[model samples]
Target: MPRIPRTKSKTGLYHVMIRGNEKKNIFRDSEDKDRFLEILYYKRQNGEFTLLAFCLMDNHVHLAIGEGTNDIAKVMKKITVSYVYYFNKKYKRVGHLFQDRFKSQVIESDSYLLSLIRYIHYNPIKSGLVNTVGEYRWSSYNSYITEKSNFPNLIDKQIIFMMLSNDPQKAKQLFIDYMSKETQENFMDLTAEENVIDEKAARLLYMNMLEEKKYKFIDPIPLNILQEVVSQLQAVTGLSIRQIAFITGINKNKVSRILRKHSKLQGD
Candidate 1:
């Protein structure tokens, strides 16, 4: 099945995620994480990308960045390839280090931009790896709050600062307060949307699975049962089979076959 091409962002900003192969640990130690960050800074200096926010996890990395001269894909390719080469050389191993392709979402609005930054910065805390975002040394939260110049990483702080307060000190205080808050209703809401999308994709795949199993008869199925299944799937995922198949590389004909078979079973 052909993979659906990802949509590029017109504004050049994206929320990107790259995971280790099979969700294995990506960072072996502080050196691995530091090397990745160093590569990121090098790329930024060469005008390949602009780092907004980032979080390095054991198995995955999240980044909020603006594409510079290079597109998001190109930027990611360069970063990952360089890091993978270094990692393999260091660990005395070979082959791919990252998963098939990185996941990305175009930031379409200011609200989402801020939310994504917070989400990325707070990943360690949210994953139960840390007690607080500020305590996560690998993330950009320290730089943002402390105004530390050690990293030389570029971040658009004015937007978030303004959202907090007009006064710089007050803005910093507010930003800290906001991040330190234990509640994550906003983050959970955003995650729910992704869950819905995943559920829909899974249901479509299940239909494809049925077709692969080759259920004997596909005709004379009851419409009501088929409709109920599809409806339940839609309610959970908010996507139609067409959309799911398009994204997931499932055959539309196979999906139809499964639906038809289920319909007949319900009728009987």
Candidate 2:
């Protein structure tokens, strides 16, 4: 079957994910990780996108970017192909290193944009790579805090700080609050986002709640409870839109919308 076209971002910004091909480790050690970042930095300088945030993992990477002189596809292709070439040459390996295509979710609204930033930065903590946000040296989190950025051309921190407040210091402090572990607990748990779905169990949970509420597709849904249900259902399983619609009688569009709204799933 032909691939469905990706949803375009009006804001030209996205939360992008690039995983290792076949669930393999992309970064075998600190040296590999460093090399990947170096290539990423060079590509960032090429002006396809503005880097906002990033997290390098054992088998994947998360990048927050705003479209610049080039589109997302070109930006990612340039980055991924180069890295793969380097990886292959160094390891004495050939063929795909990263996945066939990088995955992305548009970062449109300011609220979702901020949430996505926290989500990306929180990746290391979620993966047990580090105990604190500061401990993770590979992420762009520190570039936002320090006066002189470690990655001068690699990250765009001004936009985020501007979103936080008019005052620079106050904005930094707000970002500090937002990135802090204590603050993350107020909304979503980092690990909870990593929940793997059990399909049999998930179908039961959805049915039980629907039956209890006697919810019908035509009936007005309580947005709060509906969001909660969608989140729980997603956490427990990786059900497709059609599968979810089949169970809830809510239709594919509604299921897709709900999942998109609470899109804080597992990290890259």
Best by lDDT: 2
Per-residue accuracy of model 2 over 7-73 as CA lDDT, tens digit each: 6888898778888878789989888888888887877787767898888888888888889999999
Q: Number of clashing residue pairs in every model?
A: 4, 2
- Global local distance difference test of model 2: 0.72
Give the candidate number with the greatest TM-score: 2
Cα error, candidate 1, residue 212 (Å): 53
Q: After superposition, how far is residue 122 of candidate 2 from its true place, in Å?
A: 1.0
In order, the Cα lDDT scores of the candidates are: 0.68, 0.72
- The reply for model 2, stretches above 4 Å from the true place, is 147-152, 181-268
